[model samples]
Target: MTSTVAAIFVGFKQLGIADETDQRAIYSRVTGKPRLSLMKPPEKDAVLAELRRLGFTTVPRRANGRQQLTGRAAKKVQALWIAGWNLGVFDSRDDAALIAFVKRQTGLDHASWLHQAGDTIAVVEALKAWITREAGVDWSPTGKRDAAYLGRYGYKIAWAQWRILHPGADRIARKGFDTFVVATTGTTGMWTEISDAEWQKVMNALGPQVRAARKAKP
Candidate 1:
């Protein structure tokens, strides 16, 4: 958890090296990251050495790799973790191309990615700008609008259901009576968002078919 270790860890994360194995070989292990690994060990070691000169210790790895750091270092790690999560670094299953694109655009290829206040601010601004420019304004965090017909909370309920049916769509383009219908359609009328009461009616209409299917099941 020393400042040096903190810096080194940040460097590893920036390089998208989240595997515990990779981290140990490069940053935590006495021998340093393996020369054969794809990781750019020289840059990581350089950063680690610089931080050591600044007074962070070269402590032995704890059993957990992370628990070895002092409480202060742990807190720094946690803060960095939250910052990384907000920036979508920990999302392994997310769009790999998008993550790579962001890394390239931000030049977060080193330990100094968020090393300063100004750097952090600039990274956040750049991320927002990239999201806006590439995905369009509808994807902005604040782009959500009230439902034109369903009022405030109703739209949320309906949208949640719609999302369950279509997991890939991230946001509703507009908040309107027709928005639900349009979003739920993949190839025209395959699905539709309905109110709770309306859904009850659907269930009632399908009750006979449901019973028939159950009876027909082998």
Candidate 2:
């Protein structure tokens, strides 16, 4: 069986540069300088060799440290790597920080699922839980009533807030207002039907702040 490192090394050998001199020149051209250590059998590839020359190893050298992970653990790590890379959680792929973040979010050291299920199950579960906790959505239904219902609940507050924010010509048509009520309240429409333009009028009348406030509350 070919190890990942060995596979990489073999690929470079197959490149068929005549000798060490040609190999060194090619590496220097690509990476600014030749890495003597990387000219050997176990090491090759300019970029990877450059990383090694800078004391950066893909597998940590510390005893019993998490050098590499496989299966579900690797999947979870990959997910975190992509997310952390995009969200600027870590400047580069820092395995230790990525693992720590996953552990903190999922409350487990490994990517074992809640039950023995699929490989990505743990990643999905962790993300779902984390998103629910951090997404800032109000889980409860909006519970926003129709205009008449609102008036009944608290007449003064309802009337004041529901007062047509738009001009008379811009106000929602009677039928459209009824449609908006049915859509928002999930109840029967109070009046006749209307076109899309009328629906827009109704949405405009309700105003963004009013809708946002309702969503924020419930």
Evaluated with lDDT, which candidate comes out highest?
2
Model 2, span 70-105: residue lDDT tens = 332465445435332332223445556655666776
* TM-scores for all predictions: 0.27, 0.26
Please provide, for model 1 over 1-218, each residue's C-alpha lDDT reduced to its tens digit, 9 standing for 90 to 100: 44445556654555566787765664434444443233354545465655444454433345555323232223333332322233233332223332354468677422343234344555556654543342222222223463333332223333433332344545545334244354433224323344544433332333343334434547
Estimate every model's Cα lDDT from 0 to 1: 0.41, 0.41
- Enumerate clash totals for all models, in the order shown: 2, 0
Off by over 4 Å in 2: 1-66, 90-92, 111-120, 128-218
Q: Candidate 2 versus the native: TM-score?
A: 0.26
Error of 2 at 82 (Å): 2.0
Worst 10 residues of 1 by lDDT: 134-143
lDDT, residue 174, model 2:
39
